[model samples]
Target chain A: MKHRTFFWFFLPTGLAMFLFIALPIVSVVTQSVFAPHEAVLKTVENCTPLVGCTTETTIDQEATREIREAQPLGRFVGLDIYLDRGHLAIAELGEAWDTAETWGDFWDRLFNLPLYRALAFTLTFTFIVTPMLIVVGLMIALAVNSLHRHLKGLMIFFSLLPMIVTPLIGSLILFWMVDSRGIIGSALVGLAGDPNFSLKASTGLTWVMLIVYGIWHSAPFAFVVFYAGLQTLPKDQIEAAQIDGATRWQQIKYVVVPHLMPLVTFVALIQLMDNFRVFEPVVGFNASAHATSLSWIIFNDLGGETRQLSAASATSVLTIIGVAILLSPVLVRTWRDFKGK
Target chain B: MASKAQRRPLGLSILIYGFVGLWFILAAFPFFWTLWGSFKVELDFFSIANWTNAITGERTKATYDSAFTGAAYHGAWVQEEFWRNVINTFMVCFFVVLTSLTIGTLGGYALSRSGYRYTFWLLITALIFRAMPPITLVAGYLLPFFEWNVWGILPTTIIVLVAINQPFTLWMLHSFFQNIPKELDESAKVDGCTQFQAFRHVIVPVMWPGVITTGLFSFLLAYNDFAVTAMLLSESNRTMVPAIAAFLGTTYTEGNVMFAVAAVVSATAPLFILVMFFQRQIVSGLTAGAVKG
Candidate 1:
């Protein structure tokens, strides 16, 4: 293709991405370093015949409005928002470090910061869910592969349901089922022999519910990928392993798993990128009280009557940085492949 | 494999069947349960007095004089005017998918055909864009959209979704186009067809299978999105997912949780139908990326 034709062919998508994806990234970084204009203040003095002069301070609303209108991007604060208590909390971290008596105490204080708390859960959720889903998905793929052809299609159709449904809707379905009066919740009450045992009341239980929901929502994706990988498996290699007198487990361990290794990596990388943005489930499960994620923090900031754009932008920047770090390995590998080609 | 299965131990086969059966229940049972529950009243759905009431709809019978009723659905679809949101969702999905596929096919074809290092970089840039959570972009868009007075509307949301859908679409169609044997287009070029004419005549007809697959995914992304729609749309123009989210806020306080339940079920019905019809395309599209990698 000629450069001019290529340019015309790619122009629409390239322009859309540049305006929406690329430009917003720049906008977010710019907004992060800026803060909304503080209210303009004025002092007024009133002298009365019988009383002494009185001085009052009031917000100059007109001036504030003019300033804000003139510069809608807000005033540049240069990383002040990033270091504030709502974000990195550098000062608070320093204080907690010095004032803590024990390592456990220090850790508790560390988790108290909003950003750190969200970061902790996001990382924990990403790390735990990705690996567990891979194992569960692989197990399902193997089990389904061994099934009769008639049953295989039915199993796959059912399997895709959890993954195909909207994330918030899926979590909501699970959430309602685990309500105190709902079946699963009542069953748990009976098992524990405690009427007041509520899944939502404790942080640990909420985290567990969210993680379980994560696996349920994403495992099918892994299963489908691995199932496809299974279809293209080398028959001779499997037969050779069988002829060597290898057991079923050994054949799978040596022949099957190694063959699916690339698919596993592919699934893991995609899941990592996804699981890091764990926002919808938190909202659906109403687990924000017990657990939060980086994406959720940004959403919370950007929501409600007070649109805290600067605060949200800072979190957005941090989240983007996190994604870039998580994506670096894949990026390096892709670069190597491109170079080799 | 057939012989191997026959030679397998009985206990092992039984275990595999048992596990798959358990999994089948786990995967499918929740939607069934929810669909059944959505017809009942709040008390029956949440069953405070007896868990069996959820199954039998005891309170629902007491209230509506029937074991099952369309009262919740009526309340959701009529009283709340959820049909407006439903219409809004479809409109957004329709435009997002159309625009995304239109532009993505051209760009993807260009990338596949171009023998340049820049094509590699463009895809990598797209991969990075794909990785960024949509909420982050929402932060950037909020200020500008509000300033421009285009923040809360369907068209704006649709364009944003199309843009967000581009990276994945390009990658998918790029791979698909790569497999089409460049010789087809080259042969057309040899017969006095310009590049555009060749694309229009030769490539377009044969591209539907891949295009359909990519379109199915594009539709899914636009349909399943919550972040962009929830933030970008106004109250009157809200889509089904965000509308349901809003329902939770008002209905919970009003003791009308059944409304939200019905709305959720209604919203999910279309996706169920989509999967039923396009299961094969969805499966192939999913594997398309991973298999190539």
Candidate 2:
């Protein structure tokens, strides 16, 4: 294709992306540095009357509005919002480190900061769920691969449900079942012989539930990918291994796993990006008290009347950085491939 | 090979089937359970007094003079005007899919055909955009939309969704176009077709399978999104997912959690239907990216 034709073809999408995706990113960074204008206050004193006079301060609403309108992005606070306790919390970290008697104590204090708390959960969820879903998904793919042909589609149909349903709805379905009086919770109570047991009450249990939900929700994706990989497996190689008197497990250990390694990495890369923005499950489970993610923190900040745009924007910038770091490997690979070409 | 495969142990087969069956139940039973529970009264659904009430629908029988009731559905769909949100959702999805696909096909085709370094950078840029959480972009959009007084409208939300959706759409369609063999358009051009004419006449017809697959995914993203719709829309213009989220806030106080339950089921039913019909396209769409990457 001619370069001119290519330019015309790419123009619409390129423009849309630039306007919405690229522009919004720039806007988010700009918004992060600026805080909303504070209301102007004025003090008045009257001494003309012979009696003693008192002064009163009041917000000059018109002046405040004017300033806010004149500078709609709000006051430029430079890196202040990002450095505040709700975000990077440099000062609080310093204070905690200076005063703490032990490293554990210092770390505990650090994690109590809002951004750190969110980051901790987000990282834990991402690291744990990506590997876990990959393993479970691989097992499922192997099992299903062993199935008869007619049954495969039926199994896939069932498997896709958890993945296909809206995330919030999926989590809510599980949440209802895991409620204290619901079937699973009731069954757990029976097994433990503790009528008061509830999955919602404890942080550890809630984390387990969310992680389980994460795996259940995403494992199907890994399964489908691995299943596709399994289809094109080298039959000749497998037969060679078998003819060499290798055991079934040995054949799989050496031949199958190595073949599936690329698919595993593919699943891992996609899952990492998807899981890092974990927000819906937290909302569905209503487990925000026990667990919070970066996306959830931004959502919480943006939810109410105050709007907290600067706070949300700060978190947004930090999240973009996290995504970029996670994605650097893939980006580098693309670059190398382009250069090679 | 068949003889050797048949020599595998019977117990192993049984174990594999057993595990697979267990997984199927784990994967599928939640929707069935929720659907069943959605029909019963709140007491029977939750079953504080007796777990068997959930299955028996004993409370539902007493309350509605039948073992099953659509009262929850009625309450959600009629009383709460959840249908409007449902309508809003479809409207948004319809346009989002249309706009995203129209531009995405063009851009993706161009990228596939081009041999320039910029194509690589553009694809990488789209990848980075795809990786960013939609909520992060929401923070950026909030101020500008508010300033322009364009916040809380369906058109704005739809445009935002299409833009957020463009990166994935481009990547998928680009890959799809790559698989089509460049000789197709080349032959068309040799036969005296202009580039655009070749695309319109030859490439477009052959592109349906891949495009449809991509379109299904685009539909899913637009339909399944919560963060963008929830944040970008207002109370009156909310879509079904966000509307359900709103229901959670009010229904608990009203002792009508069943309304939210009904809304969830309503929201899920379409997706269930979608899978039943388009499972092949959906599966192909999902694996295409992974396999290619």
Cα lDDT tens digits, model 1, B1-293, are 35763387989889999999988988999999999999998898898789999999999899989999999999999999999999999999999999999999999999999998799899999999999999999999988898799989999999999999999999999999999999999999999999999999999999999999999889888888998898899999999999998998898899988999899999889989988999999999999999877
B30 Cα displacement, candidate 2 (Å): 0.4
Off by over 4 Å in 2: A46-51
Pick out the ten consecutive residues of candidate 1 chain A with the lowest summed lDDT. A332-341
lDDT of 2 by residue, A83-156 (tens): 99999999999999899999999988987999999999999999999999999999899999989899999999
Docking class of 1: high
* Number of the top DockQ candidate: 2
lDDT of 2 at B123: 89
lDDT of 2 by residue, B1-293 (tens): 48664366988888899999999989999999989999999998888998899999999988889999999999999999999999999999999999999999999999999988789889888989999999998898988898799999999999999999999999999999999999999999999999999999989999999989988988999999999999999999999999999999898799899999999999999999999999999888888988765
Q: Pick the candidate with the highest TM-score.
A: 1
- True-contact fraction per candidate equals 0.81, 0.85
lDDT of each: 0.94, 0.93
DockQ of the candidate models in sequence: 0.84, 0.84
Provide chain B TM-scores across all predictions. Answer: 0.98, 0.97
